[model samples]
Target: MAEQNRTSVAELVLEGLSERAEVKAALFVLLLLIYTLTLLGNMGIIVVIWGDPQLHTSMYFFLGSLSMVDICFSSVTAPRTLVNFLLERKTISFTGCMGQAFFYTVFVTTGCFLLAVMAYDWYVAICNPLLYSSVMTHRLCIWLVVGSYIGGVLNSIIQVTFIIRLPFRSSNVINHFFCDVPLLLALSCASTYINSMILFSMAGVIELSTISTILISYIFICFAMLRIRSSEGRQKAFSTCVSHLTAVTMLRRTTIFIYLRPSSSYSPNTDKVVSIFYTLVIPMLNPLIYSLRNQEVKSALRRTAERITVRL
Candidate 1:
């Protein structure tokens, strides 16, 4: 009977970001612009890194990977959101919702690991300059990225397995713009105590672990920067890490706020807003922040532009 109940609901309705038609239209336009910029900005970074041999270092390699992940991460939710704004029904099949949750979790978890890896890259470059090239060899970087994806996939499989086992018979209306763990758990008729425990434990293992690595790496980086005799060298060393630090802070704060807590305290309104910032705003901001702030990226862009002009 419980199994029958779970299988009965073929589709679920999404109570999206807003109820008002005007607000929906406005949000649709705003998010469309943000999504467009996110694609262009991240794609531009990838292009610049690929075209400029000078930018083909470990740092830029990681940055390129980060941009690619950002693009995938944002797309996981944004297109559905835009479509939801235009549709009156705002409905998704049960399988569709689960797939959405699964992919979002994978991309987000992968991103966390990627950020931590980037921090380690900075630590090696600053503290162990002599070993940076060997430590962050192309093969190692590739494996690190592949390992991050594997970790994310494993995490997603665990979470989604638990989710699919629960009977979602209470209600099918999710109170956010898209499918998320907390929102989906709320729709389950079965007790989600174990599910919540798993989420908390995963958060501890994934978020806390990655955050600790980043913090420790930065500590070493700061110590190394302090050892630099020249003020200009210190400033330059610090500048390279600023953008990554900013991105890490932005991602960590909102993610911890949303996922690390007990579901009993889940506030849909606040969570939805924070989700917008991380899912929509951050992707658009990351590329612009890195490109505008990094000297190497700016120089590469200038060179790429000059080449295009000469070609014409």
Candidate 2:
């Protein structure tokens, strides 16, 4: 009976961001612009890093990997969202909904690990300059990236497996623009205590672990900076960290707010607003934050642009 109930719903309806005609029109244009910029900005970062020999270092390699992940992360939701704005009845098949949730979890989890690894990279580079080269070798960087993706896959499989087992026999309507685990869990007819516990516990663990890594790395980075006598030297060291700190704070806060609590406490309106920020806004901002703040990235962009112009 439970299995039959689960398979009964062939399609789920998405109650997207807005319903009004004017609002949908405005959102379509605004979201289209943001999505375009996200692709262009992230893709630019990857291309610049790949083409420039000067950026052939551990730091830029991680930045490139991050850019690629951001592209995937935003792509998982943004395109569907744009399409839904045009359609009167915004709907997704059961399989498509689950697929979105799966990939969304994978990229988001991978992104968190990447940020944590990047924090550690900064720690090594700033705290142990002499050993940075030896410590963060190309082989080690590649393994770190591969491990992040693997961890994401494992986590996603577990979470989605739990969701798949539940019989969503009540409402086929999801409150947000995209399919999220918490929202999906809310739609199930069966008692979601186990599912909620798993979601909260896993989210808590991931958040606690990753945030701790970032905090500890920054603490060490702070001490290392203070050890430098000159104010100019200290400032230079601190500047490199600003971009990463901004990105981490934004991503962590939004994710924790959404996932670390019981689904009963969820406010549909508030969740939609926050989801838009992290899903659409943050990916758009990351490359801009990194490139605008980093002089090395700026120089590399200029070099890449000049080479392109020459070819043209």
Candidate 3:
């Protein structure tokens, strides 16, 4: 820990949140409940999907991937933030902040890529129905997942590199709950033009491009829906897209709100509010948005329950 910071610094003090005893206790309770909810919701999605062999298709496979990502994404910040809220000192050392930023970078980037892949999967399924099975076969699905991981790694490397190289000279009170890219960069005494450029470029490629792909895919889906003669098919198709649309909306809104500015011009207060949405609320909502309204998931759960009851 000491080795990570400058040699002149003797002790790394954590400058956390307020000193009010009541406020700290309240925050701890609220955040602890949210954190628990996040874990249960995401893990439940993964468990149900894995347990239901009927969900072994590409769609559910990606859904399981999404659930895993949500779990990791929320876990990266919420637990630590909850701990910080409970403790008297909320401050994280230089290394700890950097490490948090690093994992956050990885999971966040993975989410961006994963959403794009899911969009592509839907595009293939709807746009080319005859070839859907062949196109989205096990091999292709594996490749898409691999692409997501690769994109996440590459993006995280870029963001972390810029953040790591910057010099932070005192007044290290990060207004937010966690060590986000912009908040950390704001502490740098030196100019952050290089870092800002890298952050913007990375955000542009990963966030913007992925979102655009989702919109375009949905546009085509909409067109196809208009042409469907069967009412049942239309309703089912629309329902399939509704979940994807909801998830995409949540991800994109929070992402754009947070990363749409240069670090030099970012507001920590705005960042903190939006960060809570994406980092905490959004992860908790993923399973509900995707699984709650889906009849297949509900049916599978019932079947599993009866099977367990009979065995017992």
Candidate 4:
């Protein structure tokens, strides 16, 4: 621990991406391009979904929620990184740091659970097409999304509780972009055993349970596909899972990388680099993945554009 814990944290220094100015400048330009692309891509998803009414199905509903979350998730961290690139003073208040940590956790966790629900949705849709309409009713969809939000809030509360209990007498500098649990815990001056335990337990529950459920659902889907006699049927069924799988794999893999580590081994620098995936890249990739791959979305976009062009 540092000798003196000051009453006022005059400045929250960034022990930035190394001491070399050249490296920082390079990171700046690269991240700025990614940040801009993230915003535009996610915004495009929301716009395209909103403009098209046929996309009001449960799947698209989930897709819209995902876009909204990705937007919020990216906003929570990217702006700070962009600002750090340009600003002379690279500091965030203690309260602000906590705020970013809270929201980031909320959105990311919610997105994770929601993605699991999406996998299950695909399962129900393909495995039981006859019953899909009944099983995935408006009420059921609402409940599933609500459940995701509830679960995320509880998860965030547990993580945030761990963060609040830790003593920060050692260092005020939070390396990387935002306040994340693993990194923040590393800086704490207290015994973070309890917090680390809770974090691990939560990760096991959220990540393991969700991933297991999705995997099982896909297993059943695959089995059902195998039984189908027609080649077209198998291809069509597998296509349904592809986009969801892409999104889930992108998020779950990276989250496991970041959260599954011990506090002692947590690296703020590495966290920042990978954090860009979930925070910026995945969100942008999702809409594009779903939209471009699906004929319906592309056709809808074309028709919508045609209508506008005709009116003009």
Cα-based RMSD of the predictions, in order? Answer: 1.2, 1.2, 2.6, 2.9
The model with the greatest lDDT is 2
Model 1, C-alpha of 179: deviation from truth (Å): 0.4
Q: Which stretches of candidate 4 lie over 4 Å from their true place?
A: 1-11, 18-22
* Per-residue lDDT of candidate 1, residues 1-312 (tens digit): 767766567899998999998888899899999999999999999999999999989899989999999999999999999998888899999999999999999999999999999999999999999998998999999999999899899999999999999987668888898998777888888888999899889978998789899999999998899899999878778887888889999999999888887556778889888999999899899998788778888999999999999999
Better of 2 and 4 by lDDT: 2
Q: Model 2, range 1-312, lDDT digits (tens) per residue?
A: 757866578899999999999999999999999999999999999999999999999999999999999999999999999999989899999999999999999999999999999999999999999999999999999999999999899889999999999887678999899998988887888898998888888888888888999999999999999898999778767877999999999999899889886556779899898998999899999999899888899999999999999999
For each candidate in the order shown, give its overall lDDT on alpha carbons.
0.90, 0.92, 0.78, 0.79
Cα lDDT of model 4 overall? Answer: 0.79
Clashes of each: 0, 0, 4, 0
Clashing pairs for predicted structure model 1, backbone only: none
Return the TM-score for each candidate structure.
0.97, 0.97, 0.91, 0.91
User: Which regions of candidate 1 are displaced past 4 Å?
Assistant: 1-5
State the lDDT of candidate 4 residue by residue for 103-199, as single tens digits.
8888999899888888898888778989988899989998988888888888888898767766676688777767777767777777888888988
Order the candidate numbers by lDDT, best to worst: 2, 1, 4, 3
